[model samples]
Target: MDATFPRARKNQLGYKTSEVEEFLQRARRAYDGRPLPDDAPLDSERIRLTAFGMQKGGYSTAHVDAAMERLEDAFAFQERQIASRLHGDEAWLSEARTTAQVVANRLARPEGQRFDRVSRLALGYNVREVDRFADRLTRYFRDGWPIAIDDVRGVVFSAQRGGYRESQVDLVLDAVVDVMLAVR
Candidate 1:
């Protein structure tokens, strides 16, 4: 039995050892990133469970299997919560940015200091600024930020009122490039 298990560790292709290890690593990262308020007892419990599961011939396959299953469930739930919170924050930031852009546009003078509303929004929320807005537009392929395309569309549609034309979006692109370089 010892030989079979020991040798099996070297050839874990059939078993889900790597998957379990990755799951454990993710669990550790999640737990460490934002620890719970009463996490000490849970930490001790995990340590004890882990030690119990890892002892030499102490735990059966069933015990380890159950432990791993529970750990994965916990990890998945926490991961979902974290992802939801991040998406919510991004959404709020995007809205704030669009409003900020409208305000900034009013505050802007056609011939005074130039401003790039989109870049300011992206960079303000930890998104990387790029040399060109066109080059970086692909980053918003996901359905997360509302202000990115909003600003682009707004600039085009409101150009007449803003005393510019849809063609003036090129200037917005230039402003993006300017902010990217200046902010760095």
Candidate 2:
């Protein structure tokens, strides 16, 4: 079914209307099993990492982002399913395992050491705090530390100089979670 989303009122700061609509149209087509254009990009990674422009009186950003995250999950699940069918279960699991190992290896490093720090001119998540959380995540991956997906989704960090890059951290988290879910 095609989902209808609520739009922001005039003067509200939200995501760009046209971009959301265009992307949602293609998302609907994919979800609804209709053929999409040849140029359409539906990869979960692409959707997860995409940035949207903000506009006044457009779609609410929080709402759009939530919806897109759901869409990305759906696509990722479907990707796993397709891969299983195409490559057989063992092969798919093998690939997912490799990806998970890579994530685990990276997370094993000290949080601040894992990703490049953002320029001082541009603010990002506080290095010390993110590294602390990264410690938790590393434990989770390395020693089966008791943390849930909610923890990953709910992470917040303070601003600091030369902090962990926001986009990089987010992308890595997304990738790790995607692999975990796919393999599970």
Candidate 3:
């Protein structure tokens, strides 16, 4: 798989290895329990450890493997979807910024022509792009909390619903923020 999606910016999640490691840690913890121990060699190694853990009990290795596989698949799918959405939003935002700059440049033109075509185009572009970004951010705030690097939404939701420690909410929120800032 391509390491970087959307843009090659350092802040973008797919482009940053550290955050990806953190995501895998969170996901593994969500799948099993507790963040993958610090001792684990790496994120990929830790995931392998979790998969290894599935075999410890003599129950059904096949079933355990299947469950782990499902969790991994779900995490990848959700991450990609979220990243793609953020990428689209960032692209639009950049376009809006460019449009604004162009209009500002044109403002230096003779005063009579100041309110002409370029100004209108810039205003329209700003409204469209800004509205899109605002809408997307609102949606993100509404939906972002539940999705985490660890694919632990179920755990977070159930814990919150059952009134466990509220910190889990913070953890999820932080992870979401990481994804947002990192992906953008």
Candidate 4:
């Protein structure tokens, strides 16, 4: 199809062009309040979790990722506006605060114990790395420390045997993102 983003360098693989185009089109329709064929409507959370296959000479990964982030933020803002209108502003704020509190409580746990650990034989996120990131997240929530949404969205940790369970940590991160987006 048409060029939606720059191609990855000659031989490097990037997101498949058709997949990216299709997703973008669907997002546009969703944003415009048009009906989608699927039962699960597109939203910011779906955007956050969206993935595309990779192929040689496809759309640039960095560019598409940046676009997706922007798109997610826009959808989140629109959702917030709608919710605030449906409920009172205080109600919306209260819900956001509740989610923030839940996330904060989880992060408040002592380092390395904030999330469950996997079996000793299984690999998971590095304990030290995750704990350090948790400290930063705690500061962001409790101390009002400035943090970019992208920082939380893009954080990565090394893997180790018997480290924190990936799914649990990921769920917490998703919750954190929800709080951030709600308050934004």
Candidate 5:
């Protein structure tokens, strides 16, 4: 399946290959309705926070990160489903509204006040660029303007002075997308 992945030669160390395989096997089993290990944890936050040790020829970091993002999305989707079933539509949407408001509050702040600033030596999405998109998102969620998941997914920000934190913006966007998907 990973024909392009570099392999370790004789006596060379690869990404704990066995560990990766075991983890993937466990993940598949957990996702396919099978019981997980007693100590296994696959919740969204855990998935988001988890990191693997790297070896000389470990699995590609980019590949692992992409896979983790997909897994986070899946876990978030499942949580939305559960909330809908447990709390009913109105309560679930109410929770989503709260999430929207938190993002909106952040966006409403003054440019430099909105989020933790990136270091001058560091790079991140431009503050103005992100705020502009945030304005549009707020309009969609609060003012009832039409928006699609593609709109959120397609947003690109420029690079500039002390841009908003990428992880913060991304988490908010993910939550917004989750709400939109739940409504549909």
Candidate 6:
């Protein structure tokens, strides 16, 4: 019940303290191999997608986000260990490689055409920004360029009418994260 994270500045909004605390408790339990009743066991993917409501005085967003990244890494490591143990290292690695290949193929598409666009009147992620990010991802996978998981996780694109479809771009980014975590 003690404050799990520092509050935001007096006037700035941050994640709702109660929600963050509850989710952290659940994550902790899951990390310790004790999932709550009727709740699906937590995993790295779930942790990556977790969000909290905001309030005027609540847990600092940066602090909570850093904690989430660490938690996600821990869970990913645990999952990798378990999978390797059950399926053998070769199989586990093969799966990761396959996933990487799939992501690579998506990124291989030409710029501006990599993902579907929204309807003319609708808004989506900026095509140019996404293409630029995708270029970085391609280098990371193909040329051994260094790119942090946070870089991929924190990327934000401007919205444009008839821009690249948001869901499609998001899914690709998620897959890229999965591939990175699997090999890490």
The C-alpha RMSD of each candidate to the native structure, in angstroms, is 18.1, 3.0, 20.8, 1.3, 5.1, 1.3
Per-residue accuracy of model 1 over 1-184 as CA lDDT, tens digit each: 2321221233232334444454455456556775445434333124223422233333245544555545534544454455458876465445445644543453343432233334322322111222233323333322223334224422323221222232244445433322222211
The order of the candidates by TM-score, greatest first, is: 4, 6, 2, 5, 3, 1
What ranges in model 6 sit over 4 Å off?
A: none
lDDT (tens digit, per residue) of candidate 2 on 1-184 = 4435566788788788788888887777776678456736567777777777888877777788788777777887888888888988898788777877887787777546888888888888888887787788778767887876646765788888777888888877886677666765
Better of 3 and 6 by TM-score: 6
Clash number for each model: 0, 0, 2, 0, 1, 0
- The CA-based lDDT of model 5 is what? 0.70
61-138, model 5: which lDDT tens digit per residue?
Answer: 666656766776777678777887888878877877787777777777775666777888888789878877877877
Please give, for residues 40-118, the per-residue lDDT of candidate 6 as tens digits.
Answer: 7789999988999999988899999999999999999999999999998888789889989998999999898999999
| Predicted candidate 4 versus true structure: per-residue lDDT over 1-184, tens digit per residue | 5698999977999999999999998899899999577836999999999999999999999999999999999999999999988997889889989989999999999887899999999999999999999999999999999998889999999999999999999989988998899887
Question: What TM-score would each prediction reach against the true structure?
Answer: 0.23, 0.81, 0.24, 0.95, 0.61, 0.95
Write the number of the candidate with greater TM-score, choosing between 2 and 4. 4
Look at candidate 1 and tell me the lDDT of residue 137: 38
Clashing pairs in 4: none
On the 0 to 100 scale, the lDDT of residue 25 in model 6 is: 86
Alpha carbon lDDT of residue 160, candidate 3?
15
Q: Give the local distance difference test score of model 3.
A: 0.38
TM-score of 5: 0.61
lDDT of 3 by residue, 1-184 (tens): 6432133334322223444445455666654546545634323223333533211212344443444445545554454555568786566445445543443343333433322222332322222322333233334444453333333223222211212233422333334333433343
Against the unseen true structure, what C-alpha lDDT does each candidate score?
A: 0.37, 0.76, 0.38, 0.92, 0.70, 0.92
Model 4 alpha-carbon miss at residue 104, Å: 0.9
Over 4 Å off in model 4, which ranges?
Answer: none
